[model samples]
Target: MTIIRSRDFTGGRPWAALDIASMNGIGTRLHWTDQPYIWHINEGQEVFVVLGGRVRMRYRKDGVEQAVVLAVGDIFYAEIGCEHLAEPLGEARVLVVEAVGSL
Candidate 1:
């Protein structure tokens, strides 16, 4: 398998990735700190894998509110049409894979 790497956005501190293929659409999402507990949604479904550190995933209050604490190697999936929230517990790195389209 081929792995594509970013330009090291956070000085290689927090890494991110995206898996693109015909079978599924995936968009990688991440944050440098837990302060920015923001939420967003894409057109398709997505599953997030915490590659390193810890993270807390939640749904937008105005949207759906599903919360989950994720550690290293933890995997969570957001169903299609599910609006969500995500944040790093500290300095964290995450990888997201899902059935999706363009960014």
Candidate 2:
């Protein structure tokens, strides 16, 4: 059993992560970042949960770009093939669940 204090979590570099679990080809991880993630579509669904700090969730729908500011406790769901990116407003901690090796 493990108890993680999300507010206190950090990593060595931007977008660094601590892998939490993997099962049936799915993966869960805790990530710390102070920069934006690349815009790309995932091979599978993704669940992004903000554990601390803030983020600007960016995405495109029907070729139209859209975004929203996400704060602690906010959740972003990315369906497979959805083009998206996560730009951290500052040093932020997030929990992500998706398929292993997905981009």
Name model 2 segments beyond 4 Å from true.
none
Per-residue lDDT of candidate 2, residues 1-97 (tens digit): 9998877887888999989999999999999999999999999999999999999999999999999999999999998789999999989999999
lDDT of 2: 0.94
**lDDT assessment of candidate 1:** 0.59
Q: How well is each residue in 17-91 modelled by candidate 1, as lDDT tens digits? A: 333344423444542443434466757777777766788887754554667889888887776666777777777
Error of 1 at 17 (Å): 5.7
Local distance difference test, each candidate: 0.59, 0.94
Query: Over 4 Å off in model 1, which ranges?
Result: 1-37, 60-64, 99-103
Shift in Å, residue 87, candidate 2: 0.4
